[model samples]
Target: MPMNDADAHVAAQIRAVLAAAEAGGGVAPIVEAGDPILRQTTRPFDGQVDDAELAQLAEVMRATMLAAPGVGLAGPQVGIGLSMFVAEDPGSLDPETAEVRQRSPMPLRVVLNAEYTPATSENVAFFEGCLSIPGYQAVVARPRSIELTGVDLNGTPIAEVVAGWSARIVAHETDHLDGIMYLDKAEMRSLSTNTSVAKFWNQPSTQQAASELGFTLPSSMLL
Candidate 1:
């Protein structure tokens, strides 16, 4: 299918970004939070680029996410206003921490035009940091499980219920597609610098941080 004018423009921009990234050692510079691109809703994928180009784009996104050492990366974070993201977690946390967060290994996956909704009323709070924000972490309550729907790079449909840390990952990435940031729903009082988070708020759960920082957790999480 031929791209419309808007899609063609976006495709050209994407190609330019990819070319620049390749020229600059294969990793695109992550756009910061203040960029307008990060604030606008992303455009959905439609044959803007061919399958081979899309695959290359996904690979570059994967490499960028890994290099950022972040579990997720959305197109807007790299200055492309596309509804796509890459996510993966090595599940490297210690057993106790992993159990507390319900975190496990998540293989690298690319999701395009993704959206999600709560699959259960249960909510969980944990500190999250974004690469675009770079140096701050805050506690955000999110659905413990979610039904995510989207397509893969090959345009295969994806519909699944994901829980625990995986759910959080999907929720965060999907929000980018709609121009929402985690901080928008976060407990501002629970915000802390990366150093502060490491020195004071490092724990399996947010209970200690919430109590000490004068913030409150969801009723379900309160002991």
Candidate 2:
């Protein structure tokens, strides 16, 4: 049965609390690194998608992302092996209106077995982070634009073009589904708090830029 309205509301409240906590303080303990599952790349669900099971997993994914205050998350990150993921582009917050609008030009896509084809010739560098490996970030080179094809939450196929930070986020989470880490593909990497990341987002490159700033970069970033 679907979650009742009251139950859903309460769950949303709890998720909001967890998200706030994660955004400010950081995530609580989850799966440990080198737990075998993290290293295993997941296979697509070959059988029919069970609506009930899909709903349950989708809820878990959303709650997990909220709890982590992340832009996107994958099933494998939560220790599941199916090809599924959740994404919410936390784009820009309208201060006066208090309305949150998606910053990415692309739609908020729920992707399954999503693949990417770069549209632009050159890639752009963006500082990326992950919930699985908290307090660490790196400058990863991602396509300026991409064409994505995947199944939606309802198992409906979709093909769309995405660009900018939105493209980066989708690709990042999709990599999780494929058992790849952002650090594995980054040009340079560091670990720090959101405060530090925001502070140094656009500063001119300097010796200071070479190392992690603001939030201390942990010697060992992975849990």
The C-alpha RMSD of each candidate to the native structure, in angstroms, is: 1.1, 10.3
Best by TM-score: 1
lDDT, candidates in the order shown: 0.89, 0.62
Q: So what's the TM-score on candidate 1?
A: 0.97
The numbered model that scores best in lDDT is: 1
lDDT per residue, candidate 1, 52-118, as tens digits? 8888888888888889889999988887888999999998458988998999999988999999999
The lowest-lDDT stretch of 10 consecutive residues in candidate 2 is 96-105
lDDT of 1: 0.89
In every candidate, how many clashes are there? Answer: 0, 0
